[model samples]
Target: MKLFYSPFHTFVHKVLVTAHECGHWERLTRVATFPFKNNQGEDCGDTYDISAINPLDKVPTLVTDTGQPVFGSQAICEYLDATSRARRMYPAPGPKRWDALSRLSLCDTIFESTVQMVMEQWKPQDQWNMGLFTWLWPKFNAGLDSLERGAERGWDDFDVGHASMLHAISYLGFRAEFYEAKDPVYPHYNWREGRPALAAWFDTAIQRPSVASHYNQPFTSDSSAEACQAAVRECIALRAAHGQ
Candidate 1:
């Protein structure tokens, strides 16, 4: 399969982490796509016109060997788990599978909310809406608190769900300052301050070769998805040079 990959995109990072967990990271052919200014004067990243493969023109699109195109991050992660030589990320049909799926959904939802809220910050002052601030941010915090509680249960064993949460936490840290979030809600958004268990787990999660090697872009206010695409391309070159 070929993966339209990005290094700083939380969703793409999520699927990459899942692929590594399934022990099949090397199977994918990575394609780099940077965001560009569109006629609408908005930031758009579908330089590949991914819409030809995925009507949504989104990143992390996977074109399977059978010539089937799969878009969206969760769908790609599930696909990776399903086709992997080892059935490690997703459990077989059963209650355990249901539980894992639910956890995966929660992590993805949190990650999605953060992305939405952060994107909203990109609009001009006149276009910004306080209603989103009142609604979306609270939802994001609820997800964080939910994960905090889940962390109490421990997150050492790497699974798709664990990868999900780790990406959410790390992505928030990576992009927090880029938004206009203020105290109490974001307030530097030091997610580790009150969440001990999650913090401890993150300490380990970030060290994983899969996490560390695939994602190492220091937080930058590039304000364009192109930076993410560049980071992924750079990582690919580095990995190839090292024979990884």
Candidate 2:
């Protein structure tokens, strides 16, 4: 199986945690892709493009050993859980399942919206979308608060929602610490501030073997665009060979 994704390991990736927890980590061949770089401009070339395998040409795309492509973090995570060789991240259908899914939805939104803010900040400061930051900050505040409440109540075990929470919070921290642009509303934003329960939960969660395996760890293998395209071609050939 090939897992084509962004090489950035500055934050925990929910798909990676799911794969590791589900015992598919060793079975996967990680492929570094930079779809956003490709989108910057056509003159920059499409060397990183994986549109041949994935229509959206996005990262976090997983090609199964049988050559079936699964995109979207949530879909890929669910697939991993369904075929889990070890443990399942998703709970069986029940209230626990619904709650986990709900939290997953919430944190994934935070992660995606935070990505949007990062992209918007990439533009000239004058061109930065103040309105976007204004609109999103309140949602971010509310979302973290919701997570805090959940953390305070606690869970019996680590689940998909916990993985997503790691993904969202880690990236949120990364943006504030690494990105140069200052948010208009909360220039010195600190997610940890006043969210003691969430912070404690995050500290403990990061130590989990699944999250520890990739979080904050540098990608050591070949991460070039050429390598990414090669992996994409391999998946295409595999699918063709199987007449899929």
Candidate 3:
């Protein structure tokens, strides 16, 4: 199997981590792609033809040995668990599978919301929509709070559901800190700090070679102070233009 991915993307990291846990990481060939560029002219790392593999032009697109294409991290992981000799990451088709799917959906929601928040802040002032952030952030926090409560109730095991959740939490900690810092009132903003089990899970997840590779590469730093300052200026300019 050939795994086409951008090393700088958290979504790609999620897929790689799952493959590692499933013991299929070494069996796969890593195809690098240029998903992000730094200040220099050189591509950061991981070059691929996203459009060729998947029309979505997204990272973490997996190509099976039979030439089947599996896009999306969740779908790729599901495919791996289904076809591999490794222990099923997801349970058999039954109540357990349904539960795992639901949790995975929750994790996807959190990831999507985080991406939305980042785009809203970083996009040009004319393209910005403060209303979207105002509306979505509260719901995002509510979802995070629910996940926190679930973890508190002892759902932090390595089941398919919590594996996705662990990936989400670790991704947020690494990539979405700017958004979280901007909105500290988020319900589960500090959830990981006190949740030792979840924290440990995240710790282990981030240490995998796949995850470490992503962090070790150079990419545009959206969470940097300069980026935050630029976002703030853009927001203020937008507000002023609207006579707010």
Strongest candidate by lDDT: 2
The lDDT values for all models are: 0.67, 0.89, 0.61
Residue pairs in collision within model 1: 186-189
1-244, model 2: which lDDT tens digit per residue?
A: 8999986788999999999999998998899888877856667587788988889888889999889999999999999999999998988899999999998999999999999998888899899878998898899899999888988998888999989999999998888776734777877888999999999999998999898898888899998877887898899999998899
Q: What's model 2's TM-score?
A: 0.96
Candidate 3: tens digits of C-alpha lDDT, residues 128-202: 676776787677557666765665565534556666676666666655445555542352456465466556555
Task: Give the candidate order by descending lDDT.
Answer: 2, 1, 3
Can you tell me which runs of candidate 1 are displaced by over 4 Å? 9-12, 35-46, 180-185, 217-244
lDDT of 3: 0.61
Per-residue lDDT of 148 in model 3: 58
Q: On a 0 to 100 scale, what is the lDDT of residue 210 in model 1?
A: 71
- On residues 1-244, what C-alpha lDDT tens digit does candidate 1 reach at each position? 6677454543228787777777777776666643223333444434334455667667778766655677898899888988887657876688667766777888787777777766666777567666766776677777777777877976545778777777777777867656635422455667777788778877877777677646764433443446545544454455456555
What's each prediction's TM-score? 0.78, 0.96, 0.69
